[model samples]
Target: MTSKTLSAFLLNQLNELKDRGLYNTIDPLEGPNGPVIRMKGREFVNLSSNNYLGLATDKRLVDAAVEATIRFGVGSGAVRTINGTLALHVELEEKLAAFKGTEAAVAFQSGFNCNMAAISAVMGEGDAILSDELNHASIIDGCRLTKAKVIRYRHSDMDDLRTKAKEARESGAFGKIMAITDGVFSMDGDVAKLPDIAEIAESYDLITYVDDAHGSGVLGGGAGTVKHFGLSDRIDFQIGTLSKAVGAVGGYVAGTREVVDWLKARSRPFLFSTALPPGTVAACIEAIGILQESKQLQDRLWENAAYLRRGLQALGFSTGHTATPITPCMIGDEEKTQRFSARLYEEGVYAKAIVFPTVPKGTGRVRNMPTAEHTTKMLDRALAAYGKAGWELGLIR
Candidate 1:
């Protein structure tokens, strides 16, 4: 299946990655990705998934998915532009718009692809984008795809953003300038300084783009980060992921009706890729409906986060500058951090080690994701495991 030269190149690259400890060896779960998971016939408290609200395994979501599958079949057979757009897809978009308090919305197959679609559709070579330095990889790639001049500013630094915004506006080198940031930094768990970013964007006439993948179900009563800071009317392109808290597989952008229409007409993902399956679309709609109807799940998520964070900190682990539920316990060495994560697995927890280029070097960590489904006892058990791992590794005394 491969030529000799290409095969050699692949083998060499694989060796290089392994030599540098950059190769990732994946561990597949045996069954459902829930509050806990089983691997190699051993159970561990799961703290690595992005299922923040526990809706992924919720009964209502399961029923909705099954019912949609029975009614619509197992697949959506073509691209949205080529007769794949189901009534469920349209209804999901409407629900998404309502949930985000936007005039309209457009869905994509994945959150990563959604960014690629949205950014490239609106920006081009003559334009410029001001991006937060610590923004998600999807955001970075999306900006690059537009062939725009990307200007990086310090993470969550309003002053730096203001300066960069002013420079970009005054450069006269670009036809349009956009300021983009992640609403919640996934690694650090810190919220974006959105209010300040909004004000700066307004002053410089920069288009505002926020990828609120982590904030959709965790903040603003499950609306999003923009709404949390009362900037719903101010943000231009509001992007979110159905896969995260919606317990489904898709992504969306909520904006003005004109923007949504334009994206539908021009966005590559919507134009070329096959539409999300009917069942996923229907389940996504149901999940958003559940969120809009109640804040019970959101409250439980926060309670769990607080309990876990407090427990970890009290046990002498540093949770880096987090404002939300994403808890990253710092371990300075890359190899040691990997070992620490292994120790946690041995101690019966599934928190994963994050290293460069996920985060910068010397800032490697064992990131724990506490979900709403995690009971107090489950959290306590995870904490105990963390304590054991940290102590045995001399990470804590």
Candidate 2:
């Protein structure tokens, strides 16, 4: 039965969130999450999906998933360490390693799980982790899971990282030190300074980990941020997600063969959780192949992003230092940000507002993710809506 005390606490917290305009309402997508999406019987230009290459609805991925499902059934039936490691899983890992230019790779059910598994698997009680101040929530949680001292340095501040690394190393309080960061920060769309990080890691003998979830299939000719900056050989752990630009689902860690072997043997998720389904694995494999085959999709994706970013800037919207396609139209106030998003929705755009906890308070924004599938007409329409919404809310002149 439900406890009254617990229920009351939940109600109070929810009420507070709503009162502050911090409660997010989920919009059920009525169809495939593509360049345009349907919700509540209405279609809108989709500026909210992470489908950078538009491969989520591509025929090749769909066909691959269907064929694999028919051949292997719906599930893997057991954890990977048990009897669930299918041939498809092996093939996918090999493809991922080659794509990331690493000696080996290991797959997880999701990008979140990859961090949860990999961090705890390698680092333990006596170790310390030097993390970026603005790293993703998954990385933060993963660090928490391990019994390590987590030192947060300034975001992308190489000097701060160097200082912290030196202090951690000199203190002799930890057995090992790992410097982890997001290759491409999803919120602000800025790329991490991997070259500087690699240099620091080498000087301090720190293990380097880059969670390139938002970088794969978008940068480095689709190889990712590590490779984009020519540091693939320098970074120790190269993590990426298949759900974003790859247009499938799952996460992977590409590193030396020894590290991959260690993770396969020790990562908790691989040891305890059921393996990713064969269909999803097969789809991911196909997506990687698609990305490897050409740079056409990546080119189109960048072109669209550039067009949208230019339009927003021209419209007087402040797009924070975005080096990639994840464009955020900054709106400062939480309620005003939510209202701006609602206004956009009313005008046939589906850009979502990112509020507190996702970003720091007072930094709320409407993040626009323009994909390769978005045409000029669609983007122009979205810009028009942004202008109208901004004017209505007195956000711009």
Cα lDDT tens digits, model 2, 1-397, are 9999999999999999999999999999999999989999999999999999999999999999999999999999999988999999999999999989999999999999999999999999999999999999999999999999999999999999999999999999999999999999999999999999999999999999999999999999899999999998999999999899999899999999999999999999999999999999999999999888999999999999999999999999999999999999999999999999999999999999999989999999999999999999999999999999999999999
TM-score for each predicted model, relative to the true structure: 0.98, 0.99
Alpha carbon lDDT at 367, candidate 2: 98
Local distance difference test scores for all models: 0.93, 0.95
Winning model by TM-score? 2
Q: What lDDT is obtained when candidate 2 is compared to the true structure? A: 0.95
Q: What is the lDDT of residue 214 in candidate 2?
A: 96
Alpha carbon lDDT of residue 297, candidate 2? 97
Q: Give the TM-score of candidate 2.
A: 0.99
Query: Compared with the true structure, what per-residue lDDT tens digits does model 1 show for residues 267-382?
Result: 99999999999888888988999999999999999999999999999999999899999999998788888899888888899988898889999899988889999999999999
Worst 10 residues of 1 by lDDT: 16-25
